[model samples]
Target: MTVAVATIGFTKTTAENFFARLKAAKVKRVIDVRLHNTSQLAGFAKADDLAYFLKTINGMDYVPEPILAPTEELMKFFKTDKGDWDVFSRDFSALMKERKVEKALKPSFLDGACLLCSEATAHRCHRRLVVEYLNKEWSGALTVAHL
Candidate 1:
């Protein structure tokens, strides 16, 4: 089964606690879907840096798949009649079909996969949309958890 996991809160999650939760979950990789990857958070600013820390420090694989990133076009669309969700959902599904996220996720999904972004609650983040798209469109089995 393909599982998509994501963190709920961003600013509140400490790197230590985040890593600890990931270890406990036995998550093999973390797929970051932030449109802008740079974060004020010290450890999660860069993809490479986060990946390194995930692997070297937490022993979990890290993969950045921006296809899941919410773009301006997506944001603009989402602001309208919830039509943006349709557009974003379509584009995201297309990206997955193209194997873009799958390709980037290659080694990571061998065990299990989780998506990450900077929101304290999945319901409050675009990552929620991505997770929904994955679970519904791709029929990917998913569970969202916070750390």
Candidate 2:
């Protein structure tokens, strides 16, 4: 059976809406793919706060998977320098390949999981790339939905 995974960003969502979405999706685990999750800008989505909320709200387990996140250099260039996405994608893809992220994340952790980042959309975030890369590397064993 194909493992189903969902992706989400917290920028445009409130605490209520965020947990509601996760509950509705029946996400059993939340994988945080953010390199930095403690920023004040994250507010309710802060690492500690989100973990607590997920457990209280949906009995979901929170797992921080930083290996799936882009390198600090790539993030700075993309987020601060307004770098090209294609370039970032290429560079980050190479990094993922080098790191062998597919082998690092356990199949059990990915099953019924939601990948969390802060972009508000999966369109141009590393979280999206991570899922896409995994889908390809895993021989389409993963089904992904951006929420």
Candidate 3:
């Protein structure tokens, strides 16, 4: 079976609660796809801090892969697409493959994995695009859950 992916929003959730829910879901690792791993949220700023909390405290693996960060070329193309979500989606799928998202998924291959970002709503973030691309192109069975 394909690995199940989830997206969790850490916007207002406390670290403790977040970890608890992740544990409950049996998440083996969390992939932070945010362009900026640093969070405005006081406790989640540094990747090291997040890693420590997830690994040392919650016993989960953490990987920061910013595949959704818009590059210069991507930005330019986006402007041409004129906010066409489908175009953005198609391009992102290609980018993910080029970036070897499959390789990145290796760690979580044996267990459930979740992506994380700052936005409380998945639909409002680039994560939705990523998830949709994975679902369509990579045949990824991902469910986005807002924390």
Each candidate: what lDDT?
0.64, 0.89, 0.69
Model 1, 1-147: lDDT tens per residue? 655465534467677777777788777778787876777665564677888888898788777776767666655666444664556666656655665554444332533666787766675567776666555544566655655
Candidate 2 has an lDDT of 0.89
Candidate 1 has which clashing residue pairs, if any?
8-119, 8-120, 8-121, 9-119, 9-120, 10-119, 77-84, 78-84
RMSD of 1: 4.4
Model 3, C-alpha of 90: deviation from truth (Å): 7.3
Q: What is the lDDT of residue 146 in candidate 1?
A: 53
- Sliding window of 10 residues with minimal summed lDDT for model 3: 102-111
Question: Each model's TM-score?
Answer: 0.68, 0.96, 0.70
Give the residue spans of candidate 3 off by over 4 A: 72-111, 140-147
CA lDDT, candidate 2, residue 97? 95
Give the number of the best model, judged by TM-score: 2
Give the top-scoring candidate (lDDT): 2
Give lDDT: candidate 2, residue 7: 96
- As for TM-score, the candidate ahead, 2 or 3, is 2
